[model samples]
Target: MHIAEGFLPPAHAVAWGVASAPFVVHGVRSLTREVREHPESTLLLGASGAFTFVLSALKLPSVTGSCSHPTGTGLGAILFRPPIMAVLGTITLLFQALLLAHGGLTTLGANVFSMAIVGPWAGYAVYKLLRRSNVPLMVTVFFAAFVADLSTYCVTSVQLALAFPDPGSGFLGALGKFGSIFAVTQIPLAVSEGLLTVLVMRLLVQSSKGELTRLGVLVAQKQARTGTETEAVGR
Candidate 1:
């Protein structure tokens, strides 16, 4: 979700900027370290950034200042972790804001906080949790992408609600209204994103199995083969 330029009050914008600065800074460092340590990963890193840029740019009309879109942060978060995804997300948002006018410079911080920071972390958390519970890889990938896409809107709703509380009903009421409006479009978008992410992951599984295994997205071949045999015997 991209909040339009000058949509948020000055005070709210500054506050969100201040809150988001540290995460972006840390993300920069994380990205730098990743590149320095694993130069081979640079291609995949670029791919991840491209994915976020392309997917998030496909915006649809929604709330007054914001729009609904698929957040493509989940794949990067799953592959490279949230810290690196944060940097990629920020880059995508920045370019969109500058070139497409999809979002504004004034509201970049709030948008970054929601889509870049919270969305990736929340998705990655769900992915890790589900994987730990032994969920199938594609299933985990789907939910991770689904949660990432949905969580961005949830945070956007909160941001908008806090900034423009309903005069008669107040913050809670505003939150409910904003949340509901977003959900109408966001739920379907999230499911669509989830399926798309699963498809992408499947391709990666076939073509980039070594990299995926190195990134821990897939188990080592030996381990996977053993697990498959174990399941066969169990059946």
Candidate 2:
């Protein structure tokens, strides 16, 4: 969900920007080093940014003052880590606000916090945890994308609720109201994103296997597959 320009109070907006700045700064340094060291990664970086823009640009009806869409940060977060994802997310949000008018400059910080910072980190964490647990490749990918999409809206809902609490029932009431809107639209969207990401990841594994391998998308799965084969051969 995108918080529109001027949707947040000036103080809140500024606070979010301040909070997001350090991460963005570190991300810039990391990305610069990465691109310099491995020129091939530029393509991967551009691809991730494009994926986020295309997915998030498709706005659904908003609840309160913000719009909803599936965030495509899962793969990027998994590949680039949270710091880099934060940088890419900021760029994506800024461009969408300027180019697509999908989001707004004033609310850029808040949007970044929800969609870029929180969503990517949470999704990446889930992917890593599930991988360590020996989850199947496709299932891990699906959950990572799905969780990332859902988490973006969840944070958006919280941001809205905090900013505009219900006068009668307080934050919880407003949170529920804001969150329900996301649940209705974002559920199917999350599922679709999960499936689409899985397909794209599989294709990447085939087409850009070098990059995907270098990025460590399915290393655990690969190792596990080899182990299974070794066991079967022994049998």
Candidate 3:
């Protein structure tokens, strides 16, 4: 969800910018460290950024000053963690704001805070929780992507509500209005994004098993099995 340029009050805009700066700065360091330490992961990182850009760019008109779309942050968060996904999501949002006019420069901070920071962290938390409970990998992936996509809109609704509270009902009313409107389109989109993420992960599993293993997405059991199989063959 991208808030239109100049739509939010100046104070709100600056406040959001100030709040978002630290996460983005930390994300930059995380990304740099990831690239430096695992040069082979460069390709996957690029793909994750591209996925976020493409999916988020396919926006649909929604509430005033905002739109609905799939936030492809879950896959990257799952693979490289939320800190790294924050960098990818920020780059995607910035480029879209400049070249595609998908979002506005003024609202970049708010959008980044929602889609890049909160969404990934929330989704990754769910993923980790479910995985610890022994959830199937694909199922964990689906819920993670679903939560990531939906949570961005939820945060956007809160931001909009806070910026423009309803005259009669105040902030709660405004939040309800915005949240209801966002849910109309975002729910299905979230489900679609979840399924799509699962599909992409399946392909990655088949084609980049080693990479997934290194990222800890594929876990250790498969690697152990492969090693055991190799030893058996040798025997």
Clash counts per candidate, in order, are: 0, 0, 0
TM-scores for every candidate against the unseen true structure:
0.90, 0.88, 0.90
Which residue pairs show collisions in model 2?
none
Residue pairs with colliding backbones in model 1 are none
Better of 1 and 2 by lDDT: 1
**Model 1 agreement with the true structure over 1-235: per-residue lDDT tens digits:** 6889999999999999999999999999989988998798999899888888778877655544455789899999999999889889989889889998977899999999999999999999999999989999999999999999999989999999999999999999999998887755698788888998899889888888877766777777677577644543542
Give the range of the ten consecutive residues with the poorest summed lDDT in model 3: 226-235
RMSD in order of candidates: 5.2, 5.5, 5.3
- Assess candidate 2 and give its lDDT: 0.83
lDDT tens readout by residue for model 2, 136-218:
87899899999988999898899889989999999999999988876556877888789878987888888986676556664
lDDT of each: 0.88, 0.83, 0.87
